[model samples]
Target: MLPDISVVLTTYNQGKFIKKAIDSILSQSFNNFELIIVDDGSIDDTKRKIDQYSDSRIKKVFKQNEGPSSASNVGISLAKGAWIALMSGDDISLPDRLQVQYEFANSFNYKICFGLPIIIDDEDNIIPDEDFPVFFSDHSFSNRKVFKRLFEKGNYFCAPTAFFQKDIIEEKNPFLISSLQLQDFACWLSLSKKYDMPIINKRLIKYRRHANNISSKNNNGRMEFEMKMIYKNILNNMTWELLHEIFPNQFSVASMNDKRCFEIEKSFLLLKQSIKSVHEVGCEKIWNYINDDVMCSILSTKYNFNYLDFFMETGKFNTNERDESND
Candidate 1:
């Protein structure tokens, strides 16, 4: 019989924490979930450790060296459950996690659900308040507008805490196979375009941070550049959407190239003149394009335009030059 949920726990060389991760899932209060562990060519003893688990619900697949994106896609393709939960081999799920999420998803009929995670060290000890990163404090997943703004600023959800229906995974092709560093972020952005990913509001997973983690290895300037690229793609899409809504007649007649070359002056004027209408259309508190300096820098550096010009042109802010300051 198929299970109610399929928990896809992807691992690289997390042999030290693999057993605990699997144990946490097996001990979940919600029992009808299959645990599929996809080992992405770990050079360590991760496979041997997984073999020690005799639980009939645990399904292990050993694949050749591939990144987490590919490994996750493999597990997703094999998932037979109605709901799919993503976890990392180094993370620990709270006992009531699956149950709470399952009920929440069913109650709201939401296709995607995610929650905040408690940061833990390699030794499984919770990090101190000062040391713990405050990632999602300002974001509200329940508010679609707030969530979209948060996503534009940066990825706020932890991948291991995400739970969604299998249909989203199949329909969206959620993970970008080529993205090595920000694949989860890319997936979340893709899903947000068409679905509402509500936050569970409870901490349901222990996210382990260690030296060997993929994120730790790639947390450099280049990662920021890649993230900016992702944000630009999202911005371009939003711009087109805004234009299509505000200038329906012109948008309908414009060629693709003409649309791309369309002056930001017109877009800015439309936004300034119809801010209320834009907000009513669900883009409440659109900050990134207006006030975010980092986003402005990305726009200036890549698209070769000064974002502050809009503020100056609209007399919104008394500034002569683009404020190059970033938060």
Candidate 2:
């Protein structure tokens, strides 16, 4: 018989913490779960510790050094449950974590749900909430409202605290292999477009914070580039009405049906957010020209877009000297 939930716990080189993480899952109040452990090339005693677990429900997959997101993907692929729960190998989940989520999902028809994370230190002591950013766990998820919040407030849904219906993964993989730092944020953001992401606001997970933690720290400039690309992809697929719903003041009825105008407006949103690398206002057209190869082909092939005209229309193009030939 298939379990009701599959908890995917992913790790790499966190052998010291993995034992506690595994024990936490094994001791969960809910018994209808299969635990999947994806050890991503941990060069430590991670495997040795996992071997100590003789639980029949525990499934282990050891693969080469493929980063966290890739490891998560492997676990998600092997999940054999109606609902999927995400757990970090370094974090400790409370006893009722799965039961609370399962009951809530069974009652409410929500496709995705997240709980609050109580931050913890290396020795398993609780850290005060004032030290880290607060979790906006109670916000009700509406498609337009949540997308708007994600665009402005960024991700608030705690990653490993998430318990979602497995079917959504069929539509899209929740984890993106390339977005190491923003994988959870990107998944929530992407899923928000299709489902109402709710909050439990109750059950707690000990979100471990340490020097080696991958949850919060920035992984170089890759995050910035990934975010811009996320926005661009959303713009490419989202309806104009949905776009206006997210950014109400940025669109007019006349611009609603105009594809060219819509493209230009999306570029404006990206520019206002400083999503481009140059961090300059007037370079949206130039950024689109250089960054998006597909959009470049479409603009020239379909819109007959004039770069000079488009650049001048924004009115912020700076010039060394404003003369007819130079401008």
Say which candidate scores most in lDDT. Answer: 2
TM-score of 1: 0.73
Worst lDDT window (10 residues) for model 1?
318-327
lDDT of 1 by residue, 107-156 (tens): 98889888878888998888764554444554455444543544434566
Q: Residue 134 error for model 1, in Å?
A: 3.8
Per TM-score, the best of the predicted structures is 2
TM-score of 2: 0.83
**lDDT of candidates 1 onward, in order:** 0.69, 0.75
Residues 90-112 of candidate 2: C-alpha lDDT, one tens digit per residue: 99999999999999888988888
